[model samples]
Target: MNILPSYRYQMADHKKSILIFYVVIVGLSLIFGFSTTLIINGNDAAVHGSTSGNEMATVIFLFVVGLCTFKETFLISLQNGVSRKTLFTAKLLTMLSVAVIMAMIDKIFFLLYAAALSITNSQVTASTFYEALYPSSTAGAGPLMLHAESFFFEVLLALAAMAAGYFITIMFYRLSKTGKVIVGAGVPVLFLMAIPWADQYFLNGKITIALVKLILTAVNTPSHMAVTCLLAIVVFNALAFTLMRKAVVKQ
Candidate 1:
């Protein structure tokens, strides 16, 4: 039998044309980061460098990549004779794959740069490479490792964001006059549900901490954050697949 049309649609998307642009942007960031360090510390570049900025950039990069994938999903769904479910599944898988790959490349760059610095400074500690990629919690920032077990939670969160965006778009398309009000109302509704906050009566106090710990254990164990990230890839793709399978295609 011929391959599914949904998969074909993903392959046909033209946004891959932007891949070169993303690569150039990332390359420039890397060079700029390295150059900034060299400028600040003179020949002793290790003394003034940081991966935190790059890490944040990677996150932003992933978000943009997510948007591109969303565009593909939307276009695929609009195709004639294509099953909505199949279109969704294919695009979800594509997005998850792209996210995982980008995350890995980002982490690799972070670790390599960190390791180089640590070696140059002769300040190596018991901290593993994962810690290098995701620094310990400190003021003003949270842990950043999207590893193996916690992968499910993070990726699911991302997929939820994507779905939520698409749903709002659909709602707006269907209800032009009330679209703004509906989207404004729907955004906060979805945000409160997906984001794990402790002030709520249901998620407050020790229960919240317990849930957070459980999530940490799943996504990151102390050694390989990649595993958690991979798991997330699977989970998010699965969720997107399910959502698409059940979505009602209009027009």
Candidate 2:
């Protein structure tokens, strides 16, 4: 089946929200930069090179978009006689397209942030999550390399986040009301209460330490993290497809 219609639909669904999210975020960043500059000029503080991890907000935003994308789009696609395969393809395309667009915008925003920092003589530093993740690699890299690396990594990271969100919403959709309640409550309880408590008391922090060590070792560099993100995206999307294949449309 032709995937254009479904792809276009998915893109259209996210366009408005993405626009508003960026607009609000950029506006806030500008206000923050200028305000901080004003404060510095008025005071005798000598702080320099303050790091802002604000770019991480994009990942959270994409995760929210993923959570919101599946249900309505799935129902609409089914109503339009779109097969699950076609719909899934369209979603993949939509994710890639949106991720690239977002990554480019983020790069441009970083440039703007740098300019703002220079013009206003702000001490607050602007950097990408990629640089934060792989500082050693970024430290000696040229501007061109840093930008290219960040754009690619952010695209992968963004895609992975969305895939995770999509998988979660689809999993919820596949569950019954009682199952939903169990998962919604149980997962948090397991993560926030049970696991943490057990790890602290019974396991003596072994679990948390081991998990952290493993994550840190495995994702030591941007390239390594990119692979991890790719794996996450693939696994999550594959699982989502399995659920969507048998998903029954409901009101």
Best by TM-score: 2
Candidate 1 Cα outliers beyond 4 Å, as residue runs: 1-5, 11-21, 43-47, 53-56, 64-78, 111-177, 185-251
TM-score of each: 0.51, 0.94
lDDT of 2 by residue, 109-171 (tens): 888778778787666777777777678889999989888888888888899999999999999
Candidate 1 achieves a global lDDT of 0.50
Q: Model 1, range 19-113, lDDT digits (tens) per residue?
A: 66457756885686566656655754444434442433434445444544553456445656556555666656655554455455555655575
Q: What C-alpha lDDT values do all the predictions have?
A: 0.50, 0.87
- Model 2 scores a TM of 0.94
Please give the range of 10 consecutive residues that has the lowest summed lDDT in model 1: 122-131
- Clashing residue pairs in all predictions, respectively, total 11, 0
Deviation in angstroms for 95 in model 2?
Answer: 0.4
Looking at model 1, how many pairs of residues clash? 11
